[model samples]
Structures are given as C-alpha cells and as structure tokens.
Target: MAVEPLPEPLRPAGSGPAWRLRYLSTSWNGHPTVASGTITLPAGTPPAGGWQLVSFGPGFNGTPDRCAASQAGTPPFIRPLSEALLRAGYAVAVTDYEGIGTPGESSVVHGPAEAYAMVDIVRAARRLAPVSRRWAAAGYSLGGHAALWTGSLADGYAPSLRHVGTIAIAPTTQWGLQFAAAGNPAAPVNPAVPYQGRTLPVTHPGGFRAADWFTPAGLDLVDLAGHVCIEQMAAALTGLTMADVFTDPSAAMGEFTALFDPHEVPVRRYPRPVRLAHGTADQLPAVLTEITAGQLAAAGTDVIYTPVSGADHFTVAAAIAPQVVQWLEELFRRP
Candidate 1:
C-alpha cells in the first residue's frame, strides 16, 4: 500500500484533510491490480477507539481513467454524503474502484471487484491515520451495489476488519430489467444502459470482441465512452433508442448474463446490518430495490429498507444523508 497527500487541485473541494492512496487489490477477472482512493479525516482529535471509518463508494461517474474521484473532483451526487460522514466524526475512504485512475478499464458495476477495492481501502486508510478496525460500507447508485457486496464479502475477504454494516442509497440491483429493456427493439434507452452496452464486452474476462456486440453506429459511441465521462457520454448518446445502440439487441444476453449476474448484490446473506434506501421515483425503479431488500431479509440479513416517496436518482443520497449518518453512528456505537 502507498499513500501520498492528494494534490490540492485533485482533492474534492471542502474535503478538509485528505490523502491519495494506491493499494494492491484484485480486478474483476481476478488478476492482481493496484487500485487508488482518497481518505478524508475529520478536523478534530480521535476518540477512544480512534475515528470510525466509512468505506464510501461513489456512484457511476464514468468508465475512463480520467473520471476517477481522486483524480477528478468528487461528483456532486456522493460528495455531500462523504462530507456529511466526515462532519459526523468519521474518516471516509473512497476508492476509485478497479481501474478508474489506474491502467485498465474500470469494472463499472462489477460488485466483487469494487467491493475488494472498497474493503481494502479501509485497510489502507488505517495505516494512514489513527483509525478503528470497525468500519461500515456505504454508496449511492452503482456504488450502493458495491457497498452491499462489501457487506457480504468483507468478513471472508478481509477477516481482520470488523465490518459493522452497509448503507445503500438507490443501488443498481436488477440488471435483467435494464438489459431486457435494451434487448427490446421498442424500449427507450437510458445513458447507463448504452453505457454498460459499451463496457460489458470490453471488461469481460474471456476477451470478448466488441464487433460481435455493437452495430457500426453503436461502435462509434463505444469508442466515445472510452474517452469521456458519464455526463459527456450521456449528452452524446441522448435521444437514441435500443435499436440505435445495439447490433442485435437480443444477441448479447448470454454474455451479458455471464458477465453481470454473479456480481449482483445480496449474492449471499449479509451477516452485518444493512440499511437500504431508494427513491420511489428513481430511473432505476424502487421496485427492484424493494425486491432485493426482500431477498436479503429472507436470506437472514439484518436489513432496514426505506423508500423515499418522491425523491429521484440524483437526489436520493443528499436527501437521506442525515438519516444514514445517524444510522452509522448507532451502528458503530454498538458492541
């Protein structure tokens, strides 16, 4: 593990005392890789067990190397939450995930890879500051999925760390819903669907060919995705439908399922407490999150599921930040 002061320009505005980190972690395909992140410590002195930690996962920013949170300033969606946690007297560790600021393409929504990066960042953060071994995982959108995966994987993957819980705000849960819509000729496409369309083949382990999946027009957008962040990609692909973005919308199901299914959240019961919150009006849909929370509960996870009546995707994290911080406080206070 390596640590360095985050260059002033690179640190998120108002992040207070922060450090940039590069640490050893595994990629989605199981190859050992170096991952990077930022650790932001509160202004005051530590408490009895040292400052508690929150391994924060930011939502989808983009897939390219330039879009990393530690490289690019933190995105608005998750910045409030991280800052809020810091203000609440905890150190926040935010991973850039599998390849955001590093060499290869980022895994995007690959849960385990992101989870490994998330859990390991806490380990790395501990070495940098006076921190407690007890930590919680939290994230928004795509990150929310990674946070939940961290809950399930943390105990086994990093036995030395005591993972107290997880908080997921509008996490992406059902890939089938999104992919099925993409496969439908008449379905309207969201930026994320096409975004994933461009990424899945490239990130897949078997070295899947992009030509087999995208039409010529889609291929051009795929090329664009490699260079731009989510906002730019979204603008470029705006108004396109599924038919415009895929070669044969129905064709990639086998590979798509193979690539994403195993990475879905609640892959097994979460032994730690979990708090899931989603906006009823989110583009990702609250129904899917509800279903996922149900499965986790049935599987013996100690989960509290809450749906914000009218909030949408972009606002859910800020809307629930106070509640989440309180929950984390209570969680860390426990035996």
Candidate 2:
C-alpha cells in the first residue's frame, strides 16, 4: 500500500493550545475514503516521548460538521474533548465516520464497516502525527458501540497498533433489549432510538417525532422512513404480552439470535482491554454495564465495568469524565 504524504506543516508552528484541521484519504471497510478532523497539540517540540492516539467516535444522530472542533454550542463537542486530550499529552483523531461527512445515512448497521473506519482513522492519524502506536478508543452513545467494536477488532484489523483499552460512555450495549424496550407503547420516546437498527413509524404518537434529533436542519427522510416502519411494528403488538409480540417467537428469536449477539464474537480474539461505563438511571432499558461485563468475562477478556449511581444516559459523560480521563491516561502509559 502506498503511504500518503502528511499535509504541509502537519502541526502549526508556535502552538500554545493550537490545532490543525486536515483531510486524508484512507481505506475503510476495504474502500478508499476521506476522513476530516482537527489534530490538537500543545506548544512544544511535538512531545519527544511520542504521543498516544485516541480515536473518538462521536454520538449518533448528527453530522460530523456539528461536532467539528470549532462548532459553536453551549458545550462544544469535539473542541472541548480534543483540547482536553491534547492537554493530557495524547494526540486525538476524530473521524466524521464514513457517511457523516459525505452523503448517505450514517451506517447505524453496526457492522464491519463502522469498525473498520475506527481502526483506519487511527492508522491515518499515526502516519499524520508523531504519535506512538499504543492507542485507545473513546466514544459516547453510538460512538460507545463503535469504540467497543473497534477495540474488539484491534487484534485483526491493526495488530501493529497496541490496543491499550477503550472507554465507552452510556453505550447502547444490548440491541435486542433496546429494540424490545423501544417497542413498548408506554415507554418514553427516546430521540436516539432511530440511530439503532430498527424501523419506526413517523405517525406513531410515541415514535420519533422530532424534526431533527440533533440539529434543526430536519431529520433525514431515509431515517424518518426507517423509524416509521419500526414504530408501526411496535404499535401492532402494543397491548400484547411479550410472548404475543411475535407470530413466531422462534423465528423472531432466530432473526435477532443470529445478528444481534455481538458477544459471541469471542473476547479472546480481541487484543485489548475494554472498559464500559453507563448510568444506572438511564431511561433506555438496556443493561449496558451488566451485559458488557458478562460478555467480556465469558470470553475471558479484561474488562472494567462502572455504573454511575445517579447518572442517566445523557449525563453519563459529565458524571464519568474524571474516571474516563484517568483510565485513558493509564492506557497511554502502558508499555
């Protein structure tokens, strides 16, 4: 494979808290793609110790531009996180993922493609910066899933990169469970549900009714249509018992049984440590901490599970930022 040249003056000169934004084309899910982002670093000699790399998977339901380093908001998304990591002396790489920067629905499919993009961005970052091969993955919500999946595939995708560990905050761990919870008519409508791999109905009262879950640009029509189907299915079985929801429970079981069981992938196959943090008060009915811990333990992978007492899905990051940063620093320090 031909190595792409690093852009001119990769890190800006005289950089006391400075960052450079650039775009690079790399292979993701076995296809050539461009990932755009800002690489932040403190003013100095580029850290002679060599920097650690952290690939950040932003939360679901927004375009990458919304989370760009310079985007304005009450709590700036990438800028704050990127600056924090840079202050901690780690080079951070944030991908717009495959679809967020360009056209097409962001692959909520949670398959090899998203996982591959996470790994490739790290590779691209290492080549672009003076960063060490030792690395960690961090993400929130849908990103939490991406980080975990990327960490899971470290051994296979980028064996050369040291897979230190990962930190996933309030991740959607159990897809099957989330789907069941989402189908409940009495359940509070979750804006994030459309990001998952389920179809929903727009007309359903309790379904996704927001114009845009993230911004006011309006919901993507494709995502809106997908949610409509899922909502319809959920409403059809509204008053029925759990057992009655399926005409053929076995077939329903078989469908999800084959696709949603990510734990079956074998933890021994993963080359890095995994850490999961979730809020116990999360409105979403997924047992993220327990499920992730159980799967990792069953597969004999090193896992750390933390459940924030009063935190909910939305507030998980603020509640766990200190601990998350500590864990990330530890991963960077690993030999």
Candidate 3:
C-alpha cells in the first residue's frame, strides 16, 4: 500500500525546551499512518556516538499531544520521563500511536496494529534524528502491554533496531480476564475508571457508558477484577499458576485456551532482557508482577522483578525510578 504524506510540522508554541517536533507518515498493513511528537536531544550534546532510543508507550488511551514531551500541557508527562532518559544519555521517541492525535480510534485490542505502530514510530524517530538504533521500550498500563508486545517481536519488526531491554510498570497484561472480572461476561470493561478516581466520562466514543456498565460499588469491583485479570493472564500465557481462575480442567487444556487466557502469552519469549515492577499494595496489586517474573524466568530471560511493599500502581514509578533507570542504562550499554 502507498504510504500517506506527512502532516505539516507544527512549530513549538514556546521555548520551554530545545526540541524538534515533526510529523512522519508511515504505512502499517498498507494504511496511511501519521505519528507526531517531539524528540529531545541533550543540550551541548553532539550526535557523534550513536544515541540510544527510548520508545515510550503512554498510559491508557492518551494522545501523544498530551505528553509532556510535546509541550502541550504544563508539566508534560513525556518531557519529565524523556528528560530523565536524556540526562542518563539516551535519545527518546514518543509515539502518538495510531489514533491518539491524527485519526481513528486507538487499536486498544492487543493486536498487530498497535505493535506495528510502536515499531514504526521507533524507525520514524531514527529517520528524523541522529540517533543509534539501539533502543529500550517502556510503558504504563495499556502502554506497558504495547511495550512488552513490541519487545517480544522486536527482532522480526525492526532487525536494524537493537532490542536492548523492556520495562512494563503496572502493565495491563490480560484483557479477557480483566473484563470477565469486571462483571462483563461478554466484553472487556473500561480500565481507565480506577486511575481517574471517578466514573469514566460517558461522552467517550467507545461503546458502553460508565454508569450503564458499572454500578457505584462495581467501580471498585472492576479495579479488583483488573488486578486479578493481569495476574491470571500472565500465569496462563507463561505456563504458570498465579490463581485458580481457570480451574476447569477441560477449559485449561484447550489449544486456544491461552489466547484468551492472557496468562499464556509468555512475554519473555522476545529476544531481549526484561524488567517488571509492581507495588504490593497497588490498587492493581503486585501479584501481577510476580506472575510476570515467574513466566520470564521460566523462559531463561534476564528478568528483574521489584515488589514495592507500600506503593500502589500509581506511586510505584517514584519509588522504583532509581532501579528502573539503572536497568535501562545497563540495557543500552550492551553491544
């Protein structure tokens, strides 16, 4: 399929930071695609040595325009995260993903499309700047799932781009289990409500309203379900047993069982090192990380699992930033 032309570049609205923001049009499965965001290079830094690439996946269904890196809002999320990486001597690329900024709804379903967009964004970043192809992937919640999925298939997606390592902080690993636990027998419920601390907006284009799908008490129930689902999915996908959710012997033995099982994916199969962090008291719980660690370890991949005793999913980042940064630094140092 012929790729679409790039969008016109939007000038930086302010001089908060010296960075370049551009739009690159690329193709995924023959569809015209546009990825827009800013790339931050360290001040007085020359691009002689190949720069390390950090491709970030943002939480929930956030648009790249909202990232701190784009200078869209006061205290951008991407800006702080990217600055941390830049101070650590890494070049960063933040993708708006398929639907966040340009057009269409984000491919929330964990499939080839989201994975393709993420991989393409990294390539697009390299083309737009003087950066080495060596890369590390990181994300939170939904973005975490994308990072792991991309890291799992990095070799085939972009052979030129080195897959240094990946980090998934409080990732949403199992959609099917999450939905089922959220009291939806037929579909996955919205995973954004708990993080937002209120019922999700009913105006969102996605089907189903917050009130229609979940009661007041069901809000907390959905959070619990999300926690259970992530653990179960990791367990089922990785051939580990984190819980008894899938206890039916016949259901457990089926071939396609693990596809929907969330736990059967074995995320560690990707040809690179991996790190996972979760808080024990997190609204999402730390068992998900434990299950993830078990599965990755079983695959013989270099894995680092941190169980923060008092932190919740939202607060784990601050508590574990030092470890996360060190792990990423080690990955980029590899030849």
Candidate 4:
C-alpha cells in the first residue's frame, strides 16, 4: 500500500477541518491486502485529553468498486448521526471493507470481512492522527452488523485500543427468522431438505409454502448484487416476493447457514456496552433483538434494545441518531 498524506478526492471538507482519502495495508479474508477509506477530523480543537475516535461502518451500497461509500463520494456525513459525532469533537474513520473498492470479490455481507475493515481502518487512522485511546463504533444496516463485529473482534484484533461501546441501528440481527425462513414455512412446497440433495420442484406462493418464497425475479436480483450497488439491487428485488424466484424458496443456501448461527451473529460474545435501535415494522423483523439482547444481557453484556413501534428499517436510522450520539457522549466520558 502507498503510505502518504491524504489525497484530494477523499478530503471530507474543502480546507478548514481535515479529511483525507488514503489506502491502508491490511488482510482480507486472512491474506494481506490493500483497502481504502476516508478519515475526517472535527473542525474544532480537541479536548484536553485528545479527540475520541468513532470508526464508522457504512451500510451496504453494492459490491462494485465504485459502490464503496468512500469512493462513491459519500458526503461528509455518512449518516446524519455522524454529524453529531463530528460536532462533539470526535474523529471519524470510514472503511471500504477489503474488496468493495479494492481488488477482490465483494464478500457480500460476510461478518469477518466487515469486522476486519472496521478494525484495520482504526489502526490505519491512528498512524496519521493524534487520536485518543478511547473509541466506539456505530453503523446502520449492513454497517450495523460491521459495528457489532468490530466491537466483538476488537479484543482479539485490536486489543491495544480501548473500545467504549457500540451502536447498531436496524442491523441484520434477526438470524432465527432469516435462517429458518425456508426450512419452516406456513405452507410446505416440499420445504424439507432431505439427505439426498436434488432440485425438488419449482413452484409459487399459492398458500404459504416455502419452496416458492423467493421468486425467480428475486433470485435474479441476488445475482445482480454481485455486480451492482445497493439501491439498484433493492429497487429490483423489493416488491417481488421470495416465492417467485427459485425452485426452492429463498434457496436456503447451505452456505449461508453458518453466518446465521448464534455464534456467527454480532454482539453475542462481545463483552462491551451495546445500543441497538430497531423498528417494530422493519422488513428484517424486530424479534431478532429479542433473541440477541436477551442472550447478551444474560451473559453480562450491558445491552440496550429500543424498538420503534412503527418505524421501518431505513427510517429508523434518523429516528435514533440523537440518542445514539448521546450514548456515545456518556460512554466516552466515563472513567
């Protein structure tokens, strides 16, 4: 990786405050590689101790190189919530994961890839800035998953740094519903996965059968995600029900099962304070937090789960921005 001063395209602001685009040296899926990101420092002077760091993980946009948030010319505020962090005298570092903008297959929503991106960006930012040891993470949607993963892996990946807490808004947390969608459906379109693997039947959502949950149209969009950005993918797949797509509804990809496991979910074993903002009406299902928070609290993690009665998944990001910022303010000030 080319180590040097930040570049022009990455400059978060015109001149006053500081921001930079830089390439970092890190490992992707275990192999050392180069990744990219933007780091922005607040416009004002730091506190007596120093500026606290908030490494941000932006939600999934797409897998293509241009889809990387930093490369997409993402505005200074990745989220309105980030403006709050900057105003509060915190420095923000946003990573592009390893492949999204670099030389590799976009790992989709892989946990380890997002985690490494967040952790390594922090390490990279510290090299060029006067950052304090105290830090926390905040992300929404796919990025929310990354925030939790960052906190979970911080101890092992970047133990030298002190992590205050994590804030995840509408994160992909409902693993039980997500994992069991095809296996257990209201109606069975031959839902069972037998010992013998074969394409059983192609069907539709006549009743509530599972086999047709993913429509062919929907599956096509999944394939599109490999090469396009998030907005385009969502627009293509949003209204098409799962039943329309595949012979086996939702395709119960045997490959994705490991990620949906409790152990694979974020915040399960991470020992740190966590704040989750979920909307009851979210497309992903609010019940995911019920399972995650219950277990984390039981395991001695200080977890706060807030459900917005009628908020949708995307809208919930703006709804909880202030509270999440407040939470960070309180935590970073703690002894």
Candidate 5:
C-alpha cells in the first residue's frame, strides 16, 4: 500500500487543490488485502483544527479494479459535489471499494467489504495530510449502503477516529425487492414489448424489448457483470430484468441473501447523527427509505429522512449532495 500524488489528468481543475491517489493496506471479511482510493485535500485551509475528513463512497463503477472511480478520475457530476465539500473546509477520501483497481475479490454487494473500504481508506489518508479526528460518511445509490454501514461500525472499526454522522442518498435499502420485481411485468422498470406477436407472459422476466434494444446474441453477454465496467453491463440490460436471467429469484440470490438482507438493513448501534434521502420517483421501491429510516429511528438512532418529489435515482445524488455537505458542517460544529 503506497501513497502518491494524483497524476496530472486526475488532479482537480484550476489551481490550488492538492490531492493524492492511495493504495491501502486493509482487510476484507477478516483477510488482509490491498485497495485503491483518492484523497482530495481542501484548498486554502487553516481552521483551528485541520480539515475534517468527509469520507465518500461512490456508486457502482464496475467490479474490475481498473474501473475504480479513483482511476477514472473525478466524473463531471462528482466534481461539483467534491468542490462543495472542499469549500466547506473538508478533505475528501473516496474508496474505490475492495478489488476495484486492486488485487482482491470484490464483494461490493456484500455490505461489510464496501464498509471496510470506506473506513480503512480514512485511516490511510490521515497519514498523507492534515485531517481532523472528526469524519462524516456520505454516498449515493450502492455507495449509500456502504457509507451507512461504515458509520455504523466506525467506532469499533477505527476507534481512534471521531464518527460524526452518515448520509445515505437514494440507498439500496431492499435488495430482495429488486430481485422479485424482475418478473412482475405489470410495473416494468425497463421498457417491455410483445414477443413474436404475442403478449409476453408475466412470468417471463426477460419479456424482451425490440431487437434494437437487446438482440439474441446480446442476451448471452449479460453474464459479463464482474468482468467489465458497470456502464457496459447497464447498456446490455437496457430492456431486461433479473427474471430474464434468473427464473428463480430466491435460488438465484445464493450468496446475496447473506450479504444484503432486508432484515439486516442498517441500524445505528453507535450513536451519531444520520441523514437519509430518497427520490420520490426512484426506480428503487419508493417506500423503502421511509421504512428503513423508521427502522433506524426505532432502533434508537437519530435519523432525518427527506423525500424529494419527482427526482429519479440518478439525479437524486446531485440533488442531495449540497444538503449532505451542509449536514456534515453542522455535525462538525456541534459541541
């Protein structure tokens, strides 16, 4: 695990923002491993305490280490969010997650591995810059699940760091719902069409879209999930659902049940301020955040849930980033 300055292309635009790419010596599921990530230092800093670490976990980039967000460089949408945190006097550490851009198995759907990456990257980043003991976790989509889980275990995982709060934006709250919804043609998330001049059976999850959407040969390529980047896989699935591939939802999710169980949705065993947000029009079950947030509050965790009307899962991340940063600043100000 080594720390080095980011390459010229990877660095932030304009003058004055210093950043680095870090390969971390960390663990996943109790085994020693290495991971890669990016750490961006705030510009023109000098608070009474050093810059607060705002640990960010990005959504799916792909299973391959090369697709890691750190390696892809900061995407356009993410640049604004990162700048917001920087202007607020916060340092940002974004974990590529385990196995992405590093040598190791990627268990991204498995909560623990993603959580471990977010927390451990902070431990590695502290060595490279002036970071305060306080830290906050924030993420969107899949990373939302990772950020919350990290906040939940931060106290025990890295006892030296101060756990301030967590922000989960459009998180994947119920994985099972996604699997079951695959075959329900009544409410198709992906575009559906007639097959061979006959109405598609509700049971045929891959009810099928036009040839322009998913050709027969293209269907065979869906198996390439872990081998390529997320964008590619997403493109291949333009008109399909889990049912097209997995006829039996429960049986198909062999290891996933153990990893992303709704029954085991995050609970804040450790006390900290947490904020949860979801878009009203998100493809994810609309009621999920309300239910999950309620569960956290019932479990005695301080929770603030917001539902943004008309926002879809993709747009919700940008919609909520500034709000999350504001929450982090307020949490840091608290005595």
Candidate 6:
C-alpha cells in the first residue's frame, strides 16, 4: 500500500487530515490490480472504539486514469457529502474503482471489480488511521451500484471486517435494459450510453469491438470516453440521441446483455441491512431500484427502500444525506 496527501481540491476544508491511497484489489476477471482512493477522518481525537468508517463509491467518472477521484478534482457531490459524513463523526474512504488510477481499462460498471475495490480500501484505511472494525459501504449513482455489490460481497471477501450495512442513493441497475432502450428514438438521450459504448468493449472478456456497435458520429464522440472524463464526453455527445450514435442499438444487444447482466446488483442476498433510496424523477428511473429492492427482499435481505419525491439523479444524494447518516448511526449502534 502507498499513501500520500490528498490533492487540494479533493480535501474538504473542515475535514481532518486526508490522504490518497494506492492499494491492491482484484479485478472482475480475478486478476490482481492496483486501485487508488481517498480517505478522510473526522477532526479531533478518536472515539472509544475508533471512528466508524464509511467506504464510499462516487458516481461515474469516465474510464481514464485522470478521472480517478484522487487524481482529478473532487468528484460530483463528493465534497459536501464527505464533509457531512465527517461532521457526523464517520471516517470516509472513497475508491477510484479498479484501473481508474493505476492501470488498464476500468470496468465501468462491473460489480465484482467495484466490490473488491470498495472492501479493500477499508482494509487499507485501517492500516493508515484509527478506524473501527465496524464499517458500512455507501455510494451515489454508479457508486451506489458499487455499494450494493460491496454489501453482497464484503462478508465473504473480507470476512474479518465488521461490515455494518450498505446505503445506495440513486444506484443504477438493469444496465442491459437501459442500453436496449437506446434503440428507441423516443428514449431520451443519456450521455452515459455512448460513453459506455467505448468502455464496455475495452473491458469485456469476449473482446467485443466498439466499431460493431457505434455509428460514425458516435465513434468520433465515444472515443473521447476512453480519454476524457464523463462531463467532457457528455458535452461532446450532447444533442445526439442513441439512435443517432448507434447503427442499430439492438444490433449487439445480446452481447451487451451478456457483458452487463452479471454486473447487476442484489444478485445474491446481502448479509447486512441495505438502505436503498432513489428519486422518482431520476433519469435512470426509480423503477430500477424498486426491482432490485424487491429481489433483495424476496431473497430475505433486510432492505430499507425510500423514494424521494422530486429528487433527480444528481440531487438524490443531497436529498437523503442526513437520513443516510442517521441510518448509519443506527446501524453501527447494533451489538
């Protein structure tokens, strides 16, 4: 493990000393990879059992090394939220996900790769700071998806750590269906779909070709997805619908489903309680979270599902941050 001070932009003003970490984690294909993250603790002395930890996953940041949270500026919604978690007396550890910072193409939404990075960062944080064994996994958007996977995988992947719970805000699920909708001219354009068009192929095991999926116009913009951050790629692909980009969105639908299906969360029963929150107005659709929660509940996982009235994808995290902190407090209080 390697530790260094966090960059100025990523360090919240009132939070305690924070650091950037490069540690080992397993990739989706079961290969060892170096992962990076940021860790911030609450200011002042530790509590009796040391500060409880929240291992966090930030939303999509594109698939380049420069997009890693620790490398780029603070990710969307991370500063205020991290500060809030700090005020609530929890140490925060945010993973860059596998390959974003260290090496290779990042598996944009692969759950196993993300779960490994999330859980391992907690172990890395323990080495550098005073942290309680009891910790929870939390995230927003793409990070939220990672949190669900972490909740399902942590108990077996890191059996020694006392994982208390999981909290997902506007988490993504059913990605294959989302991608399939790209063929619908009526379906609203989502920049992420084009962005993933380039990334998913790079990381897929079957060696799928981006050329097989994208139109000439999309090929021009999606190439940026590999090189720039999400916002930049979104800007470049703005005003273009998926049909405008994909030759036939359904042309490679079966292959895309095969690649993305295993990445869906709540695939297995979570050993810990899971708090799932989504905004009714989120572009990703609230029904996705409802379906995931239903599956988890049916499998006997203790699930707490909440739907925010008007929150959008970007605002859902702030909408439920306070309640989420309270949920964490109650979860950690258990014996």
Report the number of clashing residue pairs per model: 0, 10, 15, 14, 2, 0
Candidate 3 per-residue lDDT over residues 132-230, each given as its tens digit: 778888876666776777777778867887778889877776544443444323323233423221212211234333334344444444344333322
Deviating ranges (above 4 Å) for candidate 5: 12-17, 183-223, 241-243, 247-250, 253-259, 262-264
Quick one: RMSD of model 1?
Answer: 1.9
Which 10 residues in a row give candidate 2 its minimum summed lDDT? Answer: 196-205
Candidate 2 lDDT tens digits, 106-203: 44444455566677777766666677777788887767877877777766777887878888777767666665554443443344333332322211
**Candidate 5 global CA lDDT score:** 0.68
Q: Could you give me the TM-score of model 1 versus the true structure? A: 0.94
The residue ranges of model 4 lying beyond 4 angstroms of the native Cα positions read 1-28, 73-78, 182-223, 250-255, 258-263, 266-269
Clashing pairs in 2: 199-230, 200-226, 200-227, 200-228, 200-229, 200-230, 200-231, 201-227, 201-228, 201-231
Ranking of all candidate structures by their TM-score, best first: 6, 1, 5, 4, 2, 3
- Report the C-alpha lDDT of model 1 over 234-282, residue by residue, as the tens digit: 8887678667876677766555766787777755577889999999888
37-117, model 5: which lDDT tens digit per residue?
888776675576777888888877666666788788776666677777777778888888777777754655556677888
Positional deviation of residue 109's Cα in model 1 after best superposition, in angstroms: 2.8
Which is the winner by lDDT between candidate 2 and candidate 3? 2
Question: What TM-score, over all chains together, does every model reach?
Answer: 0.94, 0.69, 0.67, 0.79, 0.83, 0.95
Who wins the TM-score comparison? 6
Per-residue alpha-carbon lDDT of candidate 6 for residues 86-146, written as tens digits (9 for 90 to 100): 9999999999998788878777778888999999999999989999899999998899999
Best by lDDT: 6
lDDT of 4 by residue, 79-146 (tens): 56666677667888888876767776554355666777787777877776777878888887777888
Better of 4 and 6 by TM-score: 6
Which regions of candidate 2 are displaced past 4 Å?
A: 1-30, 63-83, 186-188, 193-269
**1 versus 4: better TM-score goes to:** 1
1 or 2, greater by TM-score = 1
Worst 10 residues of 6 by lDDT: 182-191
Residue 53 accuracy (lDDT) in model 5? 87
Between candidates 1 and 6, name the one with more favorable TM-score.
6
Give the C-alpha miss distance for residue 291 in model 2, angstroms.
1.6
